[model samples]
Target: MDKNISFTLKIWRQNGPKEQGHFDTFQMKDIPGDTSFLEMLDILNEQLIEEGKEPVVFDHDCREGICGMCSLYINGHPHGPATGATTCQLYMRRFNDGDVITVEPWRSAGFPVIKDLMVDRSAYDKIMQAGGYISIRTGAPQDANAILIPKPIADEAMDAASCIGCGACVAACKNGSAMLFVSAKVSQLNLLPQGKPEALRRAKAMISKMDELGFGNCTNTRACEAECPKNVSISNIARLNRDFIKAKLKD
Candidate 1:
């Protein structure tokens, strides 16, 4: 059986993007070790409501960690101390009694604060819309073996596709670079036969979109790869750079 723990939470609160924000402290008592981080927040919000106070606002969806909606900066880590796990996967047991836990939202010029822990990640959607996909004609489904992608290449593509667009990369980087995210998205399609048609166009368009949105340039800090919940590699950035240069040469 899991034991219960207690902690002091210092959470960032804001009324809106243009409003003032500050850290509001609260004491969490007797929280179950197995309770996920979001659940503990639910408890805290419930207590605040009982006291007739406004509940803290944060973003979350599909607590199982797939949706990547839990964009929390916990205890100086982008999703707590656990590696390759989203904020929703963090559990109370990761803490100790009387520990002071700090929680904040993703901080980046590209991701403006929507309220408290929620930010306007719609910039990512705009980046994706710019050129994140291959334009394929509608027809009957193609046979799986017809494309005949090698296992190693397919695995690499899958690795890149694992990115859930959580924006932790931007949150952790001192430069707030989205290279890891964009590179991963680009590489996923770039390695396959179908995506090769627009490889140059996709690379140039996506990188241009990323820059137009005010995301910082990559400085090789590697912080994004270190803090990524999906363990996305920095290698994809190299591929993206190569593709971008080649595309420019063609233009």
Candidate 2:
């Protein structure tokens, strides 16, 4: 394979959150196959800079796929061709020489576009701030085997812990439901002993915050799990519903 491959990029450009947006086409020639997707965008920005034009801005941090900061909808997919992959982890080699790629920001009313491919995901942080953390301190240290939790229970908690709060679930959902995300958050803590103290309150607070943020209700279409970079399970949603029901019963 040639190290230098040429391609076409149709990128979304919006001046601000309030401004109307459109796609701008640019033909990239002799690009390195080794360059990551974001790196390709970097080169394109450099070219625009040399021409005395404004650079394209996109969100990115810790490109290693953990931070979930690379919030982008590339070629009709949340991240790109690779499943459970981040934009910064995507390589140019995934395409042929003449492939025409469409790059856009995550589209959702709750997440207004901040720039070209960057949207304000502070909505997630707001939801978390509502009651995502365990406030009570368990200062006294106990033995590791004191709880004797089953392996399966611990595994479920780990699965929920895998959620990175990427907002891909909202972007992929037609109704913009954050059910999968909220479910994962609740599941991680609900299944464990440490989280039992705040289980009811946590669900009520986070769900209330989610509605206040203007997110839509979950109808169980399952599109979110398909696009999620973490591959968060839909079963977590059921787990969340159970917890919510239990909380309501206590009231």
Pick the lDDT winner. 1
Query: What is the alpha-carbon lDDT of model 2 when measured against the actual structure?
Result: 0.89
**Model 1 Cα lDDT, one tens digit per residue, 1-251:** 68999889999999999999999999988999999999999999999999999999999989987997889899998998899999899988888999999999999999999998899999999989999999989999888888799999999999999999999999999998899999999999999999999999999999999999999989999989999999999999999999999999988
- lDDT of each structure? 0.94, 0.89
Model 1 scores worst on lDDT over the 10 consecutive residues at 141-150
Pull out the clashing pairs in model 1: none
lDDT of 2 by residue, 144-163 (tens): 89888899999989988999
